[model samples]
Target: MSQGDAQIDFYPATQAPIFRENWPRMRSHAIVPRSKEGWIDPVISEWSLEGAAWEDFHPHAEYNYVLEGELHISVDGEEVVLQVGDSATVPAGKLGRYWAPKFARMLTVYGPNPDGEESTDFKYEEL
Candidate 1:
């Protein structure tokens, strides 16, 4: 799908392509590219590692839907735990932290596509 074209994209039962990876933390699969500025990108992601944390300032709003396991997230000081079938949206420009006790699989969409760059980007601290 390109910019300014009205069309519907289809994905079969095949696997999605992995777009980014950071060992023992998270991996992102690209479902659709954020072809333009201020556009969200659809992605599938996996979070692993017990007690691993991701602390960062989001450049865009992140919408997540838990697919497999549990995800514990902290936005600024509030804590929220999401399980399978739960969905949440982390607003833009917030300091956030995410940790998984064991593992989690999720469908995520980033408004303005956080990885809308020539290569994958990483902007978080591990604790």
Candidate 2:
């Protein structure tokens, strides 16, 4: 089947598309097409923060791929800096935090939950 006609589909970002001229901004778009079953849901998010920090997120599971820039991600107490072309997985029920030193963009997948009832909420501190 032709590229467009095949049952399998393709996304430009999944195959390494060139970043837009105005890259590094807070933006997101759904990756996997939505469905009733909701087996897998992926979102592409870009973060451009000079000194932005996030509150603790207790999620069931989070899969992330760094597309550009650098990010400080902390799970529990240990922290790591993820750069472009890097990937990380945060397990279920873990406390995680994220910050952007300069700018960053990441593709995140949240799903494959067996119970299908996972959710997340942020707890921010007063600045």
Candidate 3:
């Protein structure tokens, strides 16, 4: 079989076997490797933020889906609150910031870095 034909498999997000005991923590499940060429990278990240403050993620394109709980995202001066099952996309070169008022988890898939770089440090004033 071709290298590209190799399939990745399923696994628990946490060390514990029971869902209730392990589902609360943040974790990442790699669906595809970065070496794979495509329009964007696909990844499943489970985030559990316990009252996290605002954090900036500079300029880069991103798409995220809220699997559980809620998240507050600020992109290009626009603020958006996301809940379970909610999804949004941030354009490339646009300033992106995210915050979680309480504990929450999300799945994010992003890319197509036109700049051909991972991330950039851009300065922005508080809105």
Candidate number with greatest lDDT: 1
TM-score of each: 0.66, 0.63, 0.61
Cα lDDT of model 2 by residue, 73-94, tens digit: 8887888888988888778788
**lDDT rank order:** 1, 2, 3
Clashing pairs in 2: 60-92
State each candidate's clash count. Answer: 0, 1, 0
Clashing residue pairs found in predicted model 3:
none
Off by over 4 Å in 3: 1-44, 114-116, 122-127
Question: Model 1: per-residue lDDT, tens digit, 23-85?
Answer: 445555556545544355454443343445555666677787888788888886899999999
Off by over 4 Å in 1: 1-6, 12-22, 40-51, 112-127
lDDT minimum window of 10 residues, candidate 2? 16-25
Candidate 1's displacement at residue 13, Å, is 5.7
Model 3 per-residue lDDT tens digits across residues 57-81: 5345678788778877887689889
| lDDT computed for candidate 1 | 0.63
